[model samples]
Target: MSTVQAAIGLGSNLGDPISQLQAALQRLQAHDAISLTATSSFYRSAPQGDAEQPDYVNACALIETTLAPHALLAALQAIERDLGKIKRGHWQAREIDLDLLLYGDAVIQSDDLTVPHPWLHKRDFVLVPLAEIAPDWMVPGKGSVSEMLAQLPDHFIQERL
Candidate 1:
């Protein structure tokens, strides 16, 4: 099967977040159908919702994969499960969170997943790391990654890896 470029957002707020993200990257590398490509520097961001939770470590990854969008999402969810992710509640703390941020500019909305992440434009955690690796990539109906980052407020601070 032909490979398609895709982007994934990784976040964690529990259980040594940096280590969790690193191990998750390793798992993605181990997958035969997914070729791990560019990865952004890890960033520490304040939790968006549920301020009671610990701050999250975030990063974005670029990959080339033979798996289709839903298949890729399933693989990522499986990885999260293996890493001990438990859905406590919406925006609540978790072991790890994996989001299929984009799929080669393809727009999709399904019961299970949404491409461009639906909230990509509003979340600095996703945009900052994404711009680090793919500043020029367009976000379908929105704008270029860099452009979107520019549109947001400058208060967002992300520590470099």
Candidate 2:
């Protein structure tokens, strides 16, 4: 199968948030269809949509995968479930959260997913970590992630852990 480069967003707010992210990385590394390429420094960010939950540990990962976009997404969701993710509501508290940020340079907009994540530009939590690992990566509609990140107002403070 042909290989595709994909970006994944990782965040956790429940339990040991940092530990959950590290374990999630391990699981992704162990997957046969996915090869973990690079990871950004872990960042701690305030909850965006749901302010009541605990603060979150956020990071970005670059992966080389043989699975198609939707299939890859399904695998990510399964990983989340394995890590004790219970989807209660949007942006609710959770043990872990995984999102398929970008799939190579592919532009996709389906009922279930959107490539280059719809809110990528708006969230410093996503851009900061993403820039750490892939400053040069073009974000399809947007320019370079690093450049865009530089221009956005620093809403949430992020610290490497």
Candidate 2 residue runs with Cα over 4 Å from true position: none
Model 1, 4-40: lDDT tens per residue? 9999999999999999999999999999999999999
Shift of residue 111 alpha carbon in model 1, Å: 0.8
Give the per-residue lDDT digits (tens) of candidate 2, residues 1-161: 99999999999999999999999999999999999999999988888777988888999999999999999999999899999998888878889999999999999999999997898888898888999888999988799998899889757845778
- lDDT to native, each model: 0.92, 0.91
On TM-score, the leading prediction is 1
Candidate 2, residue 97: lDDT: 92
Q: What CA RMSD would you report for each candidate?
A: 1.1, 1.1
Worst 10 residues of 1 by lDDT: 152-161
**What TM-score would you give candidate 2 relative to the actual structure?**
0.96
Best prediction by lDDT: 1
- Residue pairs clashing, model 1: none
